[model samples]
Target: MKTDLNQLEPQALVDAFLKYPPAGFQVHEPDNFLAFFYTRFNLLTTLDVALHQKIKALPGYRHWQNMLHLQTCFVGTTVTEYTLLSAQLSAQQMTEFLKQHIQKTRLTIIKDLPLNSPFISEMENNYSQELIKSAEKNGFLSVEGQALAYVPIDFENREDYLSRLSKSRRKNLKRKLKSLNEIDVEILATGHAKFQDAEFTAQLYRLYLNVYHQSEIHFDLLSPAFFQAILQDGDSGGTVLFYWVGTALAGFNLCYEYRGNLVDKYIGFNYPLATDHNLYFISWFVNLEYARVRGMKFYIAGWTDPEVKAQLGAEFTFTRHLVWIRSPVLRFILTRLRSVFEADHHWHQQQELKS
Candidate 1:
């Protein structure tokens, strides 16, 4: 639940990652990051419901799904991440460490590296590439994962920004904003006295759960404790913008500033009212305005929903994971089945059409 990994002790983060191990998986701490070894069935990639169902109907599908993976405890949004001691590891050191750890743990598959710009630079893209290439030489397979969406905030005002959008989008957004003319919206930070209230924390957690449950692709279910930890952490730099309909809460956006970029992390809303008021579109503009007013260089909207994000004038940045399977038989099987784990080129094509 701890939001600021910088503030928490390294051991605490390790303990948190180990809190809930998936069935048939045991936690392994190789240096600073936690990896999980799956003793039974596991998914190597995300699949659409129809394909997943079809695969489930196939014989030996359970065995096909089984593999080891890197631990990803907090995946609400894909903010580039690294090992706890990543700051201290050089590219060569990291490569050697990973090689040694994989050998020691006897892990066949390593999924979701989730390297951000900083981690990528620290590890050096060339070194990371060589590591994957070396793994491939030894029969490992690497594949592209999800792409993250981000907006660079450069306009002087909301209208100035609106002018850059397509005429239809500009008109539609203005119409959406007009519907929320009377709603009360207040942005509060962790340093604010009102944010200390336990009731607000509880309400925020409830809203988060609502959004999580409604989501089509559910990966990580964040705990209330995580929200509370981030809210209470003096160094986390977390903030929230509350949308109110008179005395009742309609919606809220939880975000933070990381190195001059406004990271729009999570959102929760009271469904019917949120839909009625067009809170999603309203929040998008409001967050952009907030970032612009604060003079932030970029606004990271997070991963998924590429079509909508592209429509909003955000740019895409793709991420990838390097996977290595130990068994020759399984490795051969995966090589033949690699297309299943590759990035959704069809989805990318659909997004390109929208653009």
Candidate 2:
């Protein structure tokens, strides 16, 4: 039987990521069997604006904020995929792993623990549930995380895919996609000649930062070295899509082809320009078409913008974060305000009710 590790993000990619992780992230290998990511995290990044401000307005808010500035340790890469343990461990073994890492940081987070995934085996699925139960029993709080969106690439062509959507959605998408005719979209694999241009690579990194700064949630600010590493590694299964408008680079998407799926990863856009061209909608169709044409089974869009992704006819898979907070007082506050951290889950629930 193929192990859970076999179904994870490519091993080579993981190695590269660790060697050049986002800013402030450090890789720690306490033993040969596992790796942990350590970082200083601001807990407020996870909360919505109103709740975040409410916390700020609380008595002793600054003191609480300083206390909540978590020295965090993540069980996995904290990237696109599920938390990948190097090997499947029994509940006892998992508990041991937790015990080893928990005390070193103010917070321990095992992120993207997949509740359901078509990519993993049945054995892995059962083991994951047991891990969650074990963690909960050991005082860990399981919080519902953002939905991982995906699209099955079974359509005959773009037209066939659009036909599956509601009439209004279809019309709107088609209108937006019309912008593609005037833009230049080029696909380049990793280690392409263009990536050798330092200036070009820097421009792409700037665009990524632009998106990051504009986002409501600011967490990991990936470094230039991280981009350089991925772009320069030819064997990493990385593919970049460059969207150009009249000799000017408008945006780019970095994705990967792995295990019969086209996995969408990072995207950088020169906004205002990107928005004017409706690049987001255009790129969605572009990726779908690209995957379909290549005979890939699925387009695994990464987590974020779930409502928009849902509107684009993408299906979603859920995950949970196993959080272990060291402070009892903070833990109590977290349990009482857990709903604030679960905006995605609540939004999904509301959608279900509406439907």
Candidate 3:
């Protein structure tokens, strides 16, 4: 079980990785935030569990300083080169520790789609060929993208949520819903929705595209396959699908129950229906109101929707990242050195943009 990993090439490393499955490892100033999380091996679960404990116990909750999507999956923390803190274990012991206690043993490596890489046609596919050929390997890969955080109508304190809203926007939404009510309109929350294939996902993807494009703000374009993976995952865990105005495909917002909070991750509205029937704001009723009724601590609307969320009396908080430890101090040093050595090439592009 005690293997010296340094002796292997990427191919061999892939073999040992699937065999032991990393609990934690070193990451340097990551590119694409995580496109290169581990050129070596995955981070382990001990550190991940510790990281989550530290994150939840941080002073943020009282201060309302919560993280959006990247809520410190210590098992998968990305780090700077050569950084060391206090993990207090040899690599061998740490490896044994992770294999023993990880709740979700079927761990996954996440890759943002359309990754800016030519060698890997689909980064997940590339990561897969290396991983699947070795282990349980049925390719149960689940991918979820971070949504722009929404400003929720209810915060830790109801007053904080209300005080943040503008009077005009609040009044307009209320009036809009009331007006709909008079016309015999009904809004319903569809239970635990799923999109089994690319077509359904494509429809949702198109709706997501329209909402993002309508804002004229830059956002990632998710493929239909991406949404299908999420829906498949949702069936195991409870998912929220809502229907509005009778025949609208409204949307399925994937929710996760973690650390006593529910995160509403992906969402797609029938944009045409949203426009034709004014169904967009109904999301406010279904997602938020449902969370409140369920006695959940927070209803996470993904990022960038803060502007619209503010209308619902949602408060905003900035997330912070802290580095505590890195192992094989020499590994940290060499990685940092590589990044610095590579920086000059990367810096020129920024310099040219300014010039």
Candidate 4:
């Protein structure tokens, strides 16, 4: 659809972006930053949708009124939202506008938001209490640039680490690896595979689907397009990793390594031994080994099943997320609304779990 900026409708704009975001947003050479970003982190898509919708519903966002939103279904960890605000605004005004949205107001709309923005200065000022409060409410990991290069690992000492061991845990993992290894388990990087080879890819696809059929939890299974995105990306120095045992694919992990962290972004696996296969257990060893070989510092495993992960020698870490708004009034409303949103989501999740 040809969008005339003058005719852009806020709600319609949201719907249009949602309905049809820009194809140019993909992770091609020129747009690689956005593409590689969206590839690894689909969560940015969630954040982007929320931002677009909320902005559209706002009382007066005249600047966006004359812009066409673009959604580029790209390959990589980040996805973003952008449009030409106006040629009318001076360069200084435009810079401030982008900086405001980039650092403030649940800036999840833009994946890989530029660090040179004014938010860098605020983060330097020991972080405003409001930013702390907003991040806590939303459960986001704050990126404080050089002030905090990393979130501290959570484990205190070896007692919790020691607890990770059981009477037969090592016996268990070694046996699983040995058995699978003997069975001719094929461990290969998914990034290197010819994903266009549907026959080869489907073998792994079926292995994953088997889990969905056997399990009760809701999982995010990829489509052919998603896998293809990763493959195309690897064609140009980007990648996703996988480990398959024989004809049955066993495990997969996706990541983008930079600044010395593997960032265990996502994974999937299937083993005849089920959970006993220690596939999940072996993941830590896999990460640690890779970290060693790659000369990386930390695993950056993300926040999930922390207690269990901590037991596996991962130290507890703390990072902060911030939300800044251009208007104080809007900031207040957002802060309050965040509380309500969390309470409701928790209730809904609990109900879902019970059901």
Q: What is the TM-score of each candidate against the true structure?
A: 0.76, 0.93, 0.44, 0.45
Model 1: how far residue 300 lies from native, Å: 0.6
Model 2 TM-score on a 0 to 1 scale:
0.93
Model 4 C-alpha RMSD vs. true structure (Å) is: 13.0
TM-score quality measure for candidate 1: 0.76
CA lDDT, every model vs. true structure: 0.62, 0.82, 0.39, 0.39
lDDT of 1 at 274: 84
Q: 1-355 in candidate 3: lDDT tens per residue?
A: 3221111012222232233332333233222121112332222211223453565586655465322222222323221101111223343343344334333322333222211212123533333333323222332222222222433334544334434566776577666555345223332222224345456557766766666566533323344444444444532343545454555565545455433345565565666656555555655555666667667655655444444564565443222111222234533543353333222223334444764
Give the backbone clash total of model 4: 32
- What is the per-residue lDDT of model 2 for residues 136-247, given as tens digits with 9 covering 90 to 100? 9889999988888899888899889889899999999989988999999999999998999999899999999988888877777888888888888898788899999999
Candidate 2 clash figure, as a count: 0
Tell me the spans in candidate 1 whose CA falls farther than 4 Å from its real position: 1-45, 53-93, 103-127, 343-346, 353-355
| Comparing 1 and 3 on TM-score, the stronger one | 1
Residue pairs with clashing backbones, model 1 = 1-226
Misplaced by over 4 Å in model 2 are 1-8, 53-64
Cα lDDT of model 4 by residue, 168-238, tens digit: 65455455544434233233443564766878666555655665455432223445444444443443223
Best by TM-score: 2
